[model samples]
Target: MLTKKKVIISIAVLVVLMTGVMLLGNQEGAAEAENKQVTIEAVNNKVYVMVQQVNFIEKAAEIEFKASLEASEEGIVSSKVGGKVVQILFEEGEYIHQGEPLVKLEEKEAGNNLRAAESQLSAAQASLTSAEVNLESEQGNFERLKVLFDHNGIAKVELEKAEIAVKVAKANVEALKANVLTAQVNVESLTDSLAYTTISAPISGMMDEKSVSLGQNVDSGTILGKVKNISPINAVIEVKQTNLEDIKVGQKAKVTIGEREPLVYEGTLKSINGSADPSSRVFKGKIQLDNPDQALKPGSFAKAEIVNDQKVEIATVPLAALAGNEDSCYVYVNDQGIARKRSVIIGETEENVVVIKSGVQKGESVICTNVTTLQDGDVIEVVAE
Candidate 1:
């Protein structure tokens, strides 16, 4: 009953209607799939969490300075008088005490001179004794002549002669006594010179070196050896000029010795240099260490860590939680079950622990382990074990 052209057009219209239905059905299916989608967990917050906040925390600070371990007291020993080295009592590296003889010079001439002076002193004493006896006898004679003259038994001229003899004998005795004193002084001088032949230590320490051998001539004030007292050693460290404010006298410092493990020493800051090195811009600070066991030696390399102050109970977080520029730190904190971005003020980072001045609350969960995939204000479900 229908024409052929009308039948063909009707077939084309039916085909287009079926295609539209198929396309609509496919789009509806895609919408259903999207509504049923689940969130992909991109952050594992439990893996990198801090176990506990350490109180009384010390900031990580280092002073990489040119340092030296030296005896608190050190000196070079020298001879006070010039002499030939006849004998050395101690060898190099020997321990010596104050006033301990270290060397002996040949004192043949000194000994002879001392003996001659003693002999002169003895002779002068004998002369003094003889003059004293003559003077006593002359005085007695003068007294007798005076008494006789009063009775007119002796002439006045005889009394005058007796008096003159007494005066002369008294003068001779006084002169001889003075000569004895001079001789005694000379003997003492010679004795002291002989003693100078034996050079002794001026301090108690280890003698590290010897400059002269037996029979070697030396001059006064010449370096004979070195005496270093290693007890209570000294350490010198260079601190940055910026840290000069923190460094002060009487602050405690810890030092490690000689690259060895478990060998540590505690020291007190002794002095700080007023001026810094112009080229390096670093100042020098000295510490006094107690080395009672004498384990630390002079010139030994040491590392010093000085603690200027202690950290307080401020907001702190793991170093991994920090984001953005190093100076401008941020963290992802949970706000009402949603991930929120917070800008925090920070200070004094050490050993993965960063101090927060503001913008983070205590006991609030912060994105610790994986924070890169989080967006601000995105709903999140806290995963708990």
Candidate 2:
């Protein structure tokens, strides 16, 4: 009975161990199947992309920069002479012409001085005339005395007195004539002072600012107002130092401002800075554009692009195909039905296309779409053109 009991217990232990081994094997198989499904899912995640066969374009190199439009002729119309403001002509913010009167100072005193100068001149002229008549009479008297003395009928003292009178009269005439000249100079000076009372615009523009009121006393160099010339306004561009080499004064450029069909304006490169800005490493440039209708305001933003004379035949690709920035730039090219990310040196852009300076060649297909989903060796299918 003991032996039979031992044989039943041993069979039950062996059966329990066999059941545990089979359960562990089934669990491992299920884990392996789950891992394999994940691998299959990864393999099925293919990105759909679009590509284009690019070619080289022969064109001149260009550089683009952004800046604002500044007034070409902006200055404060200051008081040239000090006086009380009498009349303020034209409204502030009104359009004024060159040399048009804007302000009138108190000129009553200047006018009175001018009249006084004129009276002094007239008195001098009368005195000069009387001196001349007296000189003529003295000469006649001296000649008569000389003739009488030659006949021994008059004393030599009378002739000497007549000669002295003639000398005194001539001296008086010269003095009066000098006084007339002095009076005339005073008249001219007073006339200029009176004219200075009427201050006019030195240039044609809108009155941008005013700093005076009627009946207010102002000193010389006081800013009465300002004129801003919008016609042929300045387009100021701050170009990067790297792009400053190709720009020159008098080169024609196109400027566009506003949005949704921006208005185009033709301009000439008016000036370029001699040195670069230390902080931004950019060179300032200026272009002058026409604004005949005065539609463009000062301080409006603008964009300027200048094309160099040198021509280059370089492979071009879409701007969207360039994945990185200027310093760390790259593009994706299709290599045997696979997307290969390539580091490229790029140049200027012409609208939607960009010139590939290096790392790309003519007749290569550039992957433009699905760029974000691509890897170095991502399988790609190019869309039909």
Specify the highest-lDDT model's number.
2
Models 1 onward score TM values of 0.60, 0.67
> What lDDT tens digits, residue by residue, belong to model 2 across residues 58-89?
77766678869888888679887789998999
Off by over 4 Å in 1: 1-65, 237-248, 260-262, 270-286, 309-385
What is the TM-score (0 to 1) of candidate 2? Answer: 0.67
- Give the lowest summed-lDDT range of ten residues in model 1: 46-55
Worst 10 residues of 2 by lDDT: 256-265
Error (Å) of candidate 1 at residue 230 is 1.6
Alpha-carbon error at 48 in model 1, in Å? 12
The candidate maximizing TM-score is 2
